[model samples]
Target: MQTYARRLALVLAFTLLPLSGCKRTHQIIHHATSSEPDYTPQILADITPGHIDGMKYPDFTDIQAQVNNLYDMRDVDALWVKGGKPTAQADAMLQEFSNAMQRGLRPEDYDASRWDERVANLKSPEGAALFDVALTVNAIRYLNDLHEGRTNPAHFTFGVKGYNEKKIDAVTILNTQIIDASDVTAAVDAAEPQSLQYKALKKGLKQYLDLVPQDHSDPLPEMNPNAKSIAITAGYPALQSLQQKLTLLGDYSGDANATASSADLTEALKHFQHRHGLNEDGKLGSATIDALNTPLTARVTQIVDTMERWRWLNDDYQNAAIIVNLPEFELRAFEGTGNDHHEVFRMNVVDGKSDDDTHHTPVIADQMKYLVFRPYWNVPPSIARKEIIPHMQKQPGYLGAKNYETVDLKGNVVSPNIAAIDKGTQMVRQKAGTSNSLGLVKFMFPNPFNVYLHDTNEKALFTRTRRDYSHGCVRLQDPPKMANWLLRDNSKWDEDSIADAMNDGQDNKTVLLPKPIPVVVFYGTAWSDDGEMHFFRDMYGYDDDLEKTLNGGRPYPQKPMKAVTEKDA
Candidate 1:
């Protein structure tokens, strides 16, 4: 009995040992799979201390890349002292990374020669990679600062441990990819996704990806009446391609392959024209072809550049704000209630000079507080000197005709008869009226430019393909709607009240908002909301400057001007 009992105990020990070994092996595997960083890498997410469930977090591979991508802008001393608060740097890096990822990657975009020299001379791939990493990080940091309304002093340095902190040149990496259309076309033909051309085009197009309203209208032009449609179709190699591009641009809403007869083609062309806000005639004119010949890659670049500017904004999703998209000639009131999707209010808008020289309106804030219906025009010095002054010199009665009040340095409105007295010094203002420079109503938000929204006598500007007719101030397509919306809840000023105020026709007719709504007058050549891309022309030539900044060009001496704080005004 004792021998049998001893055998049983030996068997049990062996079995127990294997089970213990299996348990240890399982523990090792679990640990290997379970470790996850407690923080997000690219965009800063407020992190709290707790065991971060691996499944709940972003993919580790993506997270690793994202962490590598974070742009730390602070001096090492400040960074270390701040416990590596990655907010500034992270914002910058995310802008660049998002821009790059969407825009497309190109081999030529990187300075392969410089990168190779570093790798060979340094004899350290790790070191070379580190420098590359540092460049990207710093670039991103600068972008974040701009986005957060810290526009000036574009660059920052990080103090490293022990050694004199290394200065990572942020500008060097910023303007790396202002790609031309030809390169992108070649890349597309070659199916080279990794080319710089591809990156530029891709990033550019990503801007327009958004969910548009079902009522989103397209105005297409007519086919040429002078030329035979069939013959022209045969001659144009990119006819189908152009059609596809137009469809992407919101030209044709019907079937992509639906054949159009000559008349149908003309109608289709007219449709395209209408969508583009061009003449509705069904003929391919110079203007129409020029628009058609515009490269997809260029459009993409504009879009991406515009989105980059958006990255520089205060991204408080909870804020109730008005966003004016200049190219689209539209304004939107976006209200975020800490929910999944934001509530939007959209209206048609009249933008600045459509001429290539004067189209761009600078991206700005949404601190609208009041409205001044039938406001008097305090003519700007530039306009007065350029437009009114020259004309006034030619005709002395021009001030009277234009209802302008010439003011002396003493701030009193001088009579038109005394224009000869003020003479060359030139101080003039247009009086408030229907025919006055400021139409029926003027919405006032105090700004440095003295620019604001108002009704326009030149309503024709709103109907054109390009609506940049104003000196600087925006002209609303629907002024009455704006008035009603602004004064809806206020008992003192309902829509009727606003109408009465308009009839009153008094300057400085200040009507306060029950709750002041924020308005963002932004210019984005490309913007994406809900995944469809919207494209616009780059009127300001700002994108080139931005492109240069991104590609290691000298830092923009005039970095984004620092944002005005509440204390500032």
Candidate 2:
């Protein structure tokens, strides 16, 4: 028994000697080639906790916790290396990082240019360990940026609510998605948005990036501000320049040297007008020239801004939604997912005016619960105080002429008097009829803004290219079509029935939908449709605000939350 104990002691001493001091290198080398490699202690000793925090990584401060989790997953061992060399996964992810700009991300943001040098330094064990930590940190940052965007939407006062900003488990993603995948690029690509709109925007981003270099050397000359509208005519000095610019934009396919606006050029100009949200007059006008003269860089910024806004959107609602793009003055209802998805309906819409702060339409997302046929327009308090009461004071018969009535807090009928309004004892409401401000019907979502989709008495407003004439609510050009689409799945309501309900002339008849549909009041100034980028005027300076935020400027003032009230139908 004594002899056996002595032999056991000798074996233990020999085994621990290599790990103790000067012989540590032999142990490290042995473990590097062993089946169960365990160089975690050495790697952890080399990479201090403050190493990444001190590095110049974009958004590193924000994602420090994720970076810590990545190291913990591997028990503090090196990730991007094997046998003191950079792994194939590291090479592939570096390649992906280089092409980050294709997704509207800056390659410099990930320090992609320094990767080759870092990989070359991996000849030493300490260098390999440091490169491993840095790569892991960058990988996590890239995933976060690709998934939830680099900027926090809440910081911009974008009214983002009910969204949890999906937190990813970096360790699991690294192990299951990237490192063990057959195709590293495919895995990285899978992390991006799955919506068709996002894919289209990404394709558009690449297209516009390619156009930047081509158009930089030859910019469109600015048009004379006092120049009158030019039509298809011979002997025009600017005709050749116009042809050259229009042809570059794919709106013209005629000879660039043509001195006259031939039939082909006229058709092309009309196409350009249609693409640019202009009146298709087939003539060169100030507005058309301004759009043409907008710098290519500005167009690139528009695409990037739109892409950033796309990242703010919640991915859950892409399956089915009614999206009202305020700048475009358009409403689109999509049904299904992926290739199966198709636009079920589209119609012109009149959003709130942006000339004043009181009337600018807000960007929000909510679910439509029901529809109110023959709806009344419950005047908001702000409108009542500023517009209605003053008008009533001036014209005693104003309420009667406008089909408006006074209602007490209990919804009981009351006489219209400026005194009761001033005392806050009564409110004014327009009744349902052909002349009613809410036209015949209103779609309700019950948001804090008191905004909803409704038919309007002023249908001619939709014909305007820039339709921003509503009082914060959206005015649908074709309410009947919207009603039909909203009630498609509800057996209780059909097209004829919906029309009958709308014209029933009753006061605010509400029909509850069997299934609520999601509605997103989105604001995107630029988007791609049918392989062409469509740009709209920045109605509310949102693009400017976003650009300032992205450029590290002063954050926009957070909007004060208004108490939800029952108003504006």
Candidate 3:
């Protein structure tokens, strides 16, 4: 029992159940020609307090109650074992465990290859009981990992709110989906997101894995950090290495020894840059060099990490949803089911600066409640204290010069004196106009992050490839277009009215939408579009943080397996 328990903990950092059933001794029933053994007592004893049950409190309790509930409903009979052997459902689950990598999971985490030996050595009823318990533990863990990510998003405090599932549902799903299914693998796959975006990433995983070479020790030539750009002239020093790397990465199909003037090589460089969210100027710049230096295996890990984050999402953003891919600095609005979700419209966006801790655009799952047109930019207290107040103190007339005001707590405009602004007794707000910091419009949502999507006065910032210049709020490229889409349920507001409201002289006009449009400020450095995988720079170092948090515990053991002999069996 302790051996199986240790194996589970070494694999995924969690396991075991506190089952809710009987202490009745193992029973066997015989008919005229057949007999089936009841291993319920064996199951209960295997997951007992100090044996295979090494998980902590509630998690242990929930799974235990659920598994016990399964046997309780079956008159304390084991669900995965029949006649002292694993049932067909158990075999189906073993296949799911073996193909776990296909879904961006590690097969070893589920004891994939090790299962066969475990089953072959299950020559005794007690061994069969342990095997059954281990199977249940792995199955539940796989389902949870595939549904809600292996690494906890809360570990990094990204503010990504996820839907929590009760542990009891773990066995409920197994009973219905696995135990009563013809295609067990299909049932297991159905546990994940059923969206096209998820499917694209999943398919791209295989394609990207195929691009990895037998060995990746030989990397491209190190580029000069100070060099602005390297021209691909004839016999360029890094040209051969560049061509070989890109060719192996599937961005270049021609020969590695192709000339520097080879259009294929140039186009391949541009294509690689495009996929990597880099400036595709068809030149070897330092940024491009950094991306090229990133190992293919690293990119594969990024894809898997992206897949894990996708599992954190529920059905909220699937229909009539707005998604802001933080790494890409892009937004996509969609309104339909996965099969016909073609109503998606995309636009470039400017998110918060990644360099500052407080300036990151928080990852959130919420709803856009309304639109505020020609809105007043109520400056935050931190900004006022750090930036505006200092400027106001230096230039006494700076307040009136920019149509900014000092407003008291009672929602009344106060005297624009520098004394009150310096004292922090009053808040600051920029008047609604063309020169306002928020430009002409803002979308409001109910979130604790105090962030929103809005029009920005710094429109020129959008033209840059890496736009992260805001103070945590997201800046939209086309707020009027977003307004029109949000107001589609209302007949009074068209694109013309939307444009008029944003451009008019009206100060802070609010328009409540008919319904809440689900919005998610999501962060994924790797994404898939049109069946092509795309990678982006980790703007806020979240990828590194998530990776570290995931690897912070004991790693899986890589011990060789000795086949079970007849004597061992």
Candidate 4:
């Protein structure tokens, strides 16, 4: 009877053992897949504490801190895996990586080519964890590049200032921006700049990239520099090629039967010239021919470079600001917010000449605090020593005839002395008048370069396509309009009152603004507006410098100015 009881006890213990095992297995599964708050132990157990340290990936070393912190927050769980397979979010992010070139980035720079292999390596749990970390690292890098730019602005010698780098935490981006989002693509797209100008440039970049493959194989014939032009005439060999090129650029809408220098061809050439920052004369001059021969691939590169520059611009300009694009010779004042924000005013501007790089405008961002009506042109020391002093010596009474006055170092009125001027102890100033270099009104932003926006005595310069005539200051075509817009907030200032202040014969009258307006003097060679891409001349060779820098060449340091020789003086 005792032996029979022992057998029954053994059977009961064995039966209950399987039931207990099943209960523990169910709990583990629940913990792994649960939506509860305290379900991290199983996930945490999957990642060993020293696994990240043991990894041999060098590409991810730069982002090691972010990756380490991200894993620690989740107790070292695999972020891109669930149920032993890659999650849908991981796949979506990989796809976005594959399309990085759409944002002016090289996909290979982000290891996009290795994505398929990385995804396939997810079969093993260890492989899954490492792949997850890599995806997170690359995603963070991609977002950063899209937000700020691949190259730092300081790499170029543009005197760029006020660039605020966007700081983002990898874990936060994963949890908030990606994890619960229904549309992963849209979530990722939010990383790019929000400016409408950037979007337009991005669209333009895509279009130009598509055109690169269709570039013409025919080499365009060179033009004779002394020849007047190649115009409407029969039997011109280059005409058909020109027509074909214009057609490829969408500038020529005429059919294949259209001949060169025909009315249709002339109009198309004019359009092309307009787009390329040339005079639209419809004649094939050397400049026009050279521009026409610029390969589509080169234009694609220009579009890419422009897009890169757009990334460096400030994301916010304090709700209202003025932007002067030096290459385009235009100033735009923008206001409002988001979709409502746009250019309230746009006008032609004359920027500094790039003559031997002496008068090239310095790119900077600052605030305009006041307007000086009938302001004096305080001659720069270099200009005074080099240009004015010699002229005064050669032509007696030249300063008085030009409305210029002599000023001691203390700014007190003094008699013009040739020896004092030659010694550089005294300065010169042009009194406010119609002939004053600063014209009627001057806008002051107070930069180190001593550059400002003002009316020009030489208004005819604005009519030229390339107006780089100033000595580092911007010349406004319509100073009255700018003053009226700037002082609109002050009830005392209206259009009529502003005009009176400008023309009231009150010399050097200064009026402080109610609020300071931000001013950004920038250089961009290409931009898009109204669904059309516009290209401009790299007036200062800045584009060439930037291109070399972007292509891994060292940026050339600016040369120091040569001392003025006796002859020059």
Candidate 5:
């Protein structure tokens, strides 16, 4: 697009400058067109690349187009310099740069530590111009990282499809919102995600960063290899260490040195288990010890990484949507927007099994358009071929026992003969009834993943601590609750109507919602909610992928596999 981006360049010229004007040359001198920016405010003359700028800034390579447009809007004149000194706005921005860690950003990445020296060295017009240019570059970089993220979400491969949603122009926010705002800090703050979830993580990050350990504590004793649970007998070696950890985490409030009462120890252990994604049985098992041994700083890093993923979500959807956090096996429906958004409801969910390739739930976002009542269970061909057909071949009465039958491509009923099923000429489907695999209702959404939220016949699975037993689709613990809330605005449907539709031996039917609700299947190993921090099992090593990418540094791999669209075809 443009030539080489303006970088930090050295210069020697005028020593001091006036605060107001360097000399404003009016272009189209009298009445300006709508598109032209006011040249009257641009104080310094067009800066020469290296002759006007410093070592604090490198070439503005990452944000090429937006940076060009920002500079061009003011006709290459100095926007940061008024007289010879950095403006109050520049100071406000510089202060924010130093405090970037609170926003899960590295201050040094934006030249936070280097700004004061650069500002103090501004002696001539050359120095002033370079200072102005360097500030522009760093400010843009900081805002871009804060608004979207340091790296793109497409790099993490968390979603079924790369969730590289369109990013907002930080340059526009800088030009319009931050530059002349009465409150610069608030304006810069406004650039970040305003959702409650993001705020919770940020709060936790600040709290943990403040307490990040300088040195490691003595390691907890390893559990016996075959032991199922740690014994809580008096004077146990691991008990004291566990107590210390529990106290640090706010789980155990009593004496860290004293041997705790059996009941108190169990309760604290349960609290720790709940915060982590483990069975809240209060037993100090190996998994719990593993979670306990995890350093506080590691948790902070985990949170920072999760915050980066939040930037990938669609802004509108982030505020109000049904979000399923895979690792937590929970879905929360949030309503409203900004920090004021409240969780409408939440329910435990059964996500896909992770022990195999075909069953892992894919992360994605889409509109849940309708609900199907008494939906027939159209068994996927893979499942049919691997499990169903083989079972039926051995047990001739398996089809009848399981309420399954064969169907042709045209939706006509056919014999459950082995030949047709083996030849792939016919597909298997369970009848629409209470005993159907898809429980009594089906919530449909459009995505390439071919997954949906639905009621499941095996409701008992919800009782288990680990509920990843489904085949890619999400199984709701409380389908009736989900239906009632989702259909609250539809006059014809109430709790009774929804219950009636889900039962009564009716044929499979679908109800299109009056308005669609956003549904997002998400994966985050660490989350903060209600002023409490949560850490979950990696479940799918997504955390590993993200941590690797973050450590590998810049030019983050975006879209490891390109998304196909009609434009490409």
Candidate 6:
């Protein structure tokens, strides 16, 4: 332990120690990489710790350690600061913190007395703790700003000398070009193989890093030596096409046309597409190309945004969590510590309808409970009034024909004669069946929106590249498969037993949750891991909106009002 501590001290000393020669070398690397005509001066002026090129000055071991310390404290601080009132030290710390972040200066360079004042403001134990948490949160953000390309390595400037600020201006022009334009997707389609302007833009976008790195650290168990051939398939060709598109995006030099007969090559591609939210179709397609075309800078922005959201969540988020990618229309359940022991439990989903104003689901949630097999769809009153009633009105005995019954709030079954009931006031209840709105299984969780994962009667929708056919709730393409996974850990319920339940063709078998799991439904336009950036279509136009917000077009609360009120209200 003492040796480890000494090594840490050495690393810190390396980062803190000032040297004339190293700064000159950094200046040289900065000039060498300075392709921009405008950024030459700014780079020289802000030469500090944050902007040091990782490729050139590789030993960030000390700075990395300091950043981690700052993060730890900042997390604690974020919890305790309340009511927006800062104690003197807190105020000073916050100001110095923000200034240091903005200037890209190191935290240690800031006045410690400012922190002292904020600490002085804490009269109560609770207040002190709160102040500490806020301080820690600020420090964490400072670290993030350094790591993400948002702030300079040593200075807190929003972009590198020339790239970041100007790139957004250019992207703004592109966004404008799309506005009032009919068929924006078609415009993107026509520009495929990328226009020269877009090529430059793509390069600029990749200049930033975002998102947690993919868990490639875990070495997969050795496969059978004799297993030379494994059948490869992607649920959607769009994803396969996306890989080729990314190859173009990355401009991978080796071979574009090389066919992979090697089992490892095929397996790797599947893993790649799967990680990128592709259908694992193994076959490349246009949708995948679109995903590949997304730039890294934008993905970095996503990471910045998601990290901010992380601050809003409770510390419990640090534990095991399930993240559902809404655009990919997929659910992934993971169990583990931070970047450790994380394994996927299941993946399958259909998305929200593209045109439905009310059905778009955000990808943020807390707890997920029981798995309902052969679940019944209690027809929402709105759907009953809007869709079912219309059908009943047009065709006499329609409710009876569809095996639907009428029920009161008391749960008393009242079989209403479709011909006799008042068309304007009466509502019908649909019984559970193979033809029921919710198919054989539904994963239930308490949430503001009554959305949940359920089996779908329209199984064919999952095959579409744009799988947004559902009203709002996620419709699993393979509910039986998901059911098997949910039951895998249960001693009484095995895969075969779950399959038997689904195959039994029964209705409404509600199974209580053995251990409730957490599910987070989140939407991100950009995501990153390692160095690769994956982009998804901004289904809700969130990326564009966020970009607008960042550019000072509108406040966040006002921007997503529709999504908020529709989901919560």
Pairwise TM-score winner, candidates 2 and 6: 2
lDDT per residue for candidate 2 within 1-569, as digits (tens), equals 75565556456646677566534444444444444345566456544453443235523445556666666655455777877666788878888789888887777767777877777777766567667777877788778667766665555444544545555566678977776566888877777767777788888778778876766324344557688777766665566666777777778876655543477778888898887788788877778878877776787778777777666666665444788889899998898877777787788999887887667777767789998899888887678887898898789799999899999999998988787887777988888888988899999887767889999999898888889888778999999988888788888788888878888746798888878878888787776778887888888888887777656621223334343333353
What is every candidate's alpha-carbon RMSD to the true fold?
Answer: 15.1, 5.3, 10.7, 8.1, 7.7, 20.0
What's the TM-score of every candidate structure? 0.59, 0.86, 0.86, 0.81, 0.82, 0.52
Clashes of 5: 8
Give me the runs in candidate 3 sitting further than 4 Å from their true place.
Answer: 1-34, 50-62, 82-85, 113-117, 160-162, 165-168, 214-217, 255-261, 416-424, 553-569
Find the number of clashing residue pairs for candidate 4: 0
lDDT of 1 by residue, 293-372 (tens): 55555655565565455434333311335677776677776544434335456766666664634323555554677877
- Candidate of highest lDDT: 2
1 or 4, which is superior by TM-score? 4
C-alpha RMSD in Å of predicted model 6 compared with the true structure: 20.0
lDDT measured at residue 286 in model 5 versus the true structure, 0 to 100: 82
Worst 10 residues of 2 by lDDT: 553-562
Model 5 Cα lDDT, one tens digit per residue, 1-569: 11111111101101112322232222222213323223333223433232223444465666655655676675555567665577788888888888888998777767788777777766665556556767777787777677777666544434432245546677888888777666888877777877678888999998888776642456687776478986566666766676777877888898766777878988988988999988888887788888888888778878888788776766656665789998899999887766567888899899877786457776677788998889988877767887898899899889989898889988799887777777778988898887887889988876655688889888898887788888788999999899888888889989888888888836788889888888878887788877899998777666777778767665566764334210000
Residue 425, candidate 5: Cα error in Å is: 5.0
Which regions of candidate 2 are displaced past 4 Å?
Answer: 1-61, 124-126, 216-227, 232-234, 254-261, 416-425, 553-569
- lDDT of residue 523 for candidate 6: 60
Regions of candidate 5 where Cα sits further than 4 Å from its true position:
1-59, 81-86, 113-131, 150-166, 180-182, 214-216, 255-262, 335-340, 392-398, 416-425, 560-569
Candidate 4: global Cα-lDDT? 0.73
lDDT of 2 at 232: 67
Provide the clashing-pair count of each candidate structure: 65, 0, 2, 0, 8, 42
Which residue pairs of candidate 2 clash?
none
Point out the higher-scoring one by lDDT: 2 or 3: 2
